[model samples]
Target chain A: MDQRSIADVTVLSPTGRIDLDTTPPLQDCLLPLTQVASAKVVVDFAGVSYISSSGLRALMLGAKAARAAQGRLVVCCLNPAVAEIFRISRFHLVVEVQNDLAAALAALSSSAAAAYRHG
Target chain B: MTGKPIHMPRLRLVGQAAEIGPAVDTVRRFALAAGLPPESCDALALAVDEAVSNILRHAYDAPVDSAVTIDAAADGEGIEVVLADRGRPFSPLDRSPPRLEGGAADRPVGGLGIHLMRTLVDRIDYRREGDVNRLTLSKYRTAALAAGAPRGEDGADDTGA
Candidate 1:
C-alpha cells in the first residue's frame, strides 16, 4: 500500500487482495483519514485485483466517518474483478466511486481537481 | 449435479480468521485445475473466503480451538466447495438480505458477507446435520459457458461461476 497527497486529496493505492486477513492495513489507512474534518480521500483500486466483503465493510465504516465529518471519500480505478464485486455489493450508493482518479479528485472539490490537472 | 468431486484432500483448520486466505487459495487452485475460468475461479474463491469468515465470526467463541473443514470437487459442469464447522448451528442463508436501496448512512455493513456469498457463487445451501453446520457453495462451468454464450434462457441454465 502507498499513500500520497495530491493537493488536499489523500490518495491511497492498495495492491493485491483485500480479504479477511488483509483488510486491516486498508482500514488503518482509511479510517483515521476519513475521521478528519473536511477530509478529501481517494482509494485507488487500480492495483487491487480482488476485494472481499470484508474490505467493503472497512470502506463502509470509513464512509460513515467521512460523512459524519463532512468530508469526502471516493474510490477509483477498479480492476474487472474488483469492479464486479463493487457492482454486486452496490457500494457506489454508499460512497462515491469513479472510473478515473482525476474524476475522483474532481468530485472531492474544484481545487483538488485543478491540482491533479496541474500535476 | 451428480458429478463426483475430483479426488482432492479435505482440509481441516482452526476456525480462525487467518485461515481464510490459505483455504480460499486452495479452492482457487482446485477450481482452476478443474478447468474453471480465471474469473470463475476467483469468484468461487471469494465465496469460500466469505463462508470461512462467517464461521470464524459467528460460529465459534474461541476460533482457535474449534475446527473448520473445507473440501472442493469439480467435474465437467462446475465446482462445489463444502465448508463444515463444529460451532453453533448458524444458518447464514436464513439472515435477511442486505438492504442496498439506501445510502451509506442507512446502509448496513454487517450483512454483506452472506449477500456476497449469494452473489459470487451460483447457489449457496446451508444445512445443519447432527451437530455440524454444513455450507455448500457451487459455481458452474455453465456459468462460464453462459458468460461467453449468446444471451438467452440457456445462459441462465445453471449457477453462474
Candidate 2:
C-alpha cells in the first residue's frame, strides 16, 4: 500500500494492482527517501500480486536513486506469480532478492552496512 | 461541479472472471474496428484483461461492483486503450523485479499480469485524472496485419453463460 521507513531502512510493500494506474504512490514514497539518506532499501512484494511496465519503471527509478545515494536496494518475499515476472524481465540480475523479511533485512543491513563501513 | 461525462467509453460490469471474457471481447472489438490483425487483437485483449483482472482481484479483492472503462481509439499508426478505475495507485511496474527461483509451472498465476501487459503493448502510460486512475496502453499493428491477417474472435469463456 505504501513504502515506510524503519530502523534506517525504507520498506516498500505494495498491495493491490501495480499497473499504470497504481504505481505513483509507491514511487513518490520510495524515491525521495532513497535520494535523501541513501539508506538501505527493501521492497516487500508479498502483498503485490501484479507488476506492469510502469511498476518496473518505479523500481528502476528507486534503484537509480539508491545507487546515486550510495545506498543499496533489494527485493524480498515475492510471490511465485510475481517472481515469474522478475525472471522473464531479467530483473533478477539487477536487483538483490530474498525469500522473506528477515533475509531481506539481513541482506540490506549487512551489504549496505559493509559498503558504508568499508568506505 | 462540471457535468461533462468522462468522455471515455461506456463502462458496464459487476466484477467476475466472467466479466473478463466480455471485457476482453469488448476491447478486441474496438481494436478490430481500428484495423488490428487477429493476433494483435488477441494480444491487446489479453493485455487489457491482465490489467482489469488485477483491479478485480487486488484492487477490489474480487470481481464485483468495481467499474472499468475501455476508451480505445487510434493515435496515428498505433491504437490506444485507456483503462480507468477508482482504486488506489499502486503501480507494479514501479517496483523492483523480484528474484525467481523456478520454472513457470512452479510459479504462481498472479504477478504475470503486468509482465504480460508490458510484453504485449508497445507503450503503457499511467496517470491520475481527478478521482480516477487512468492507464493508456498502445500497440502498433505488424506487417502481417496489413497483409490480411486472420480476423479471429475470442470465445466467450464465462462459465455462467
- C-alpha DockQ of every model: 0.70, 0.03
Best by lDDT: 1
Full-model lDDT, candidate 2: 0.65
State candidate 2's DockQ.
Answer: 0.03
For each of the candidates, give the backbone clash count: 0, 18
Query: Candidate 1, residues B46-112: lDDT per residue as tens digits?
Result: 8888888878777876635558889877887777788888888987766778898777899987789
Estimate how well candidate 1 is docked, as a DockQ score: 0.70
Model 2: residue B18 alpha-carbon error in angstroms: 20
Worst 10 residues of 1 chain A by lDDT: A80-89
Task: Please list the residue runs of candidate 1 whose C-alpha ends up more than 4 Å from where it truly belongs after superposition.
Answer: B144-161
When only the first chain is scored, the TM-scores of the models are 0.95, 0.85
